[model samples]
Target: MSAAETAAETAAETATRRTPGLVPVGETLRSAERGPRQPAADPGTPPARMPWSFWRLLGSELGLTFRRPRNLLMLAALGVVPIVIGVALRVVAAEDGMGGIIEDVAGNSLMLTFVSFSFLVLLFMPVVVSVVAGDSIAGEAGAGTLRYLLAAPSGRTRLLAVKYVNAVVFAYAVTAAVALPALATGLVLFPAGDVTLLSGTTISMGDGLLRIVIAVGYVGAGMAALAAVALAMSTFTEVSIGAIAATIVLIIVCQVLRAIPELGSITPYLLPTRFTNFDAVLRSPIDTAAMGEGLLAFGAYILLFGSIAWARFSGKDITS
Candidate 1:
């Protein structure tokens, strides 16, 4: 071999001897220069997480709710109220004869709605909201299903938001349940004509029907606030019945306090106080002020109690 070739061979042999089984310097440099070869992703490793959809959760909850016999019975009961009222009123009008305010309202289907709503807003609506709200979280916990729910991919806050939304939807459903039956019974039993406003101005039947819808919506909004309050109470206890009873008691206390002449100032702030204010829909000019105050009060209540519920629920340890 030539002297230069022999020298190159000797250097290569020395390098191979010095670093036996070692990678070449060039290969090592190339490896170091390149980005890290991420350890092959473990096939067993879980995929990245995504939040569960609130609508999907709500829809599931609604499915469970409507499937319950108690819920169906409650709806049936609300539906019966208008039928009973219509039959009783018809009997009274036929026997004793319509007179005074009764004579004025006898043939007015809209008036029947007003009368039914007056009674319903005072008791039935609140009771329905209370029952559903009390069942929202407490019922699940009571039935030991809360643990399974918490095991879902959704976070506590998202779960709570879904529950609150469910309660609101339920309140609206209950309100509609009451209003629709009353409207139907009124149309069947009485005459649909110009509605006499509380201000004594007459509005077209179409306008009156629109106002009735607005009135139903207002009641639903008010019931939604009550649902928030009941929901907050529900979170603190696992017993659904206890939660429901407590909510009813609280409502009764508020109503009693509101009735006292001495507490007139604070009565305006009471939850039940604004429920009946939907009557303002019957006013000629449509007393927007009364409705605005009622809606504002309901909003405030929702904010206050909904915050309490979130705080309580987020920290709650679900053993069930």
Candidate 2:
């Protein structure tokens, strides 16, 4: 090569040298200059995020949900559980007569509350809520579908909201499943008319129904809090099983505490035990102080865990 040509070539080579941690722009330009022009990002394309629509996200989630066996099993349980339990109790208790059941409920809010906490709000419903919430976002990340969802126009906040709603809805459904059967059976078999309450009172069916609704509502709130806890755990784990298992362990630990003698005293101080007492509504005069305390404790749990989970989720490099 001629000296003049060599000097020019050396200058071009020096211009194309790469800088650390950055693309070699000059070299890239040289190569691309000989190639076809690239197309710009399409404006028509949806935003590379979860579409903020509530039901829209739910649609995507439902599709993802139906494809999985775990969610389906949970749904099935939500539907059939109440019917079965109600039927069985109806049959067995029929031999003894509804009179005894009504007597038990009449003037006995503590029994009702104990039954409520023991069965629905305390553990079972919380587990279901946590499973759905914990699995909603984390399961996607675990299964490598989170990127696709995040790209679908839904933002992290919207995604979390949808999951929370789904968890609440499902939790309500599950509680009704467990409760309605018992309630309906109790109503049909036992005379659910004006009944005496623990507080030396009598209330008509309407009043009792109102109390039931309120108690169920608290159950829903407790479930929501537990769901938040599970979701927090989920952010830390890709494996849905780990999230669900962790939630179950948290519940089991509470139940074990409730069973121990002196520890059982402290157990009532625990939110789980507090959540278990729905029968308090049936008492002549409902004692809601403990229930109130439980709800507040659960609320605190929801705020703390939910904030952490949201921070982690929103701050994470979600492309993976």
Candidate 3:
């Protein structure tokens, strides 16, 4: 073979080796004609989060909250407690000569509501609200669903807002649970009439019913306060029980402290400690001025705690 042919073969081999995984120059040029593919996006920007879509989010929470045994137990207790109280009042009044069966029957509506809700606000309502609200986020996290929720198309802010609303709504629902049945039973057992006011005035049955409904509204406000506190504590705990326990303990302690008599003037400011006084509703005229103040204070506490909880929830890792 001639030196010229040999040199030409060597050059060809070198050129091929230099272009690893190379196609023909013509093919390479043709491929380059197609522009870069969408810049090979990095894991996508992650579509904006839309956490709260009202009915949608509430439906999700309702399904989960009802699954809770604690909530079921609360419902049972809500029913049972009032009936027991009614029977007790029936017996006690008989012995004390407060009234006969007819009078008792007439008074049952307002009386039973007063008794049942008093029991709830003093303990059961707070516990129920805390358990449900507190567990909302933290429980989801514990169950390993928090991360999935965070990653969902819903925005984090909206998501947390929905959760917060769910907590408040659940609080109202659970709190009202005892009220409805108790009132119904009382009305069946006792005769109802215009509420007797503190000032020796009487409100017709219609007016009394309206006042009672108004009281329910105020109590709902109280429940919202409890829900806010529970939701805040919930952010601190992965176990819903932890949030529940903390709220219960705090409430009990505050209540005990407020009952000290000497704490009288300032006690009502303790938010959940001295708020609901049923007398305000049954009296001659609605006298909610005091409770209104307490409600304002409770509102402040709820807002403060709720803000912190939301901020924390927004920043949490949400691994689960």
Highest TM-score: give the candidate number.
1
* Candidate 1, 1-320: lDDT as tens digits: 89999999999988667443333334433443442456677899975434446677889988877788888889889888977887678677775656754554566887777778888887777888899888899998889887666654555677778888888888988888888888888888888899888788999999999999999899999999999999999999989988899989989999899889999999999999999999999898989999999999999999999999988887666656
| Model 3 regions more than 4 Å off | 1-54, 67-69, 99-108, 262-266
The number of clashing residue pairs in each candidate reads: 0, 18, 15
Whole-model lDDT values for every prediction? 0.82, 0.65, 0.70
Q: Given candidate 3, what's the lDDT at residue 79?
A: 70
Q: Which parts of model 1 are misplaced by more than 4 Å?
A: 1-52, 95-97
Which has the better lDDT: candidate 1, or candidate 2? 1
lDDT of 2 by residue, 151-170 (tens): 54456666777776676666
Model 3, span 145-245: residue lDDT tens: 76566544455566667788887777667757777777777886666775555466777878767766877777878878878888888888778788888
Q: What lDDT score is found at residue 289 in candidate 1?
A: 99
Global CA lDDT computed for model 1: 0.82
What TM-scores do the predictions have?
Answer: 0.82, 0.71, 0.77
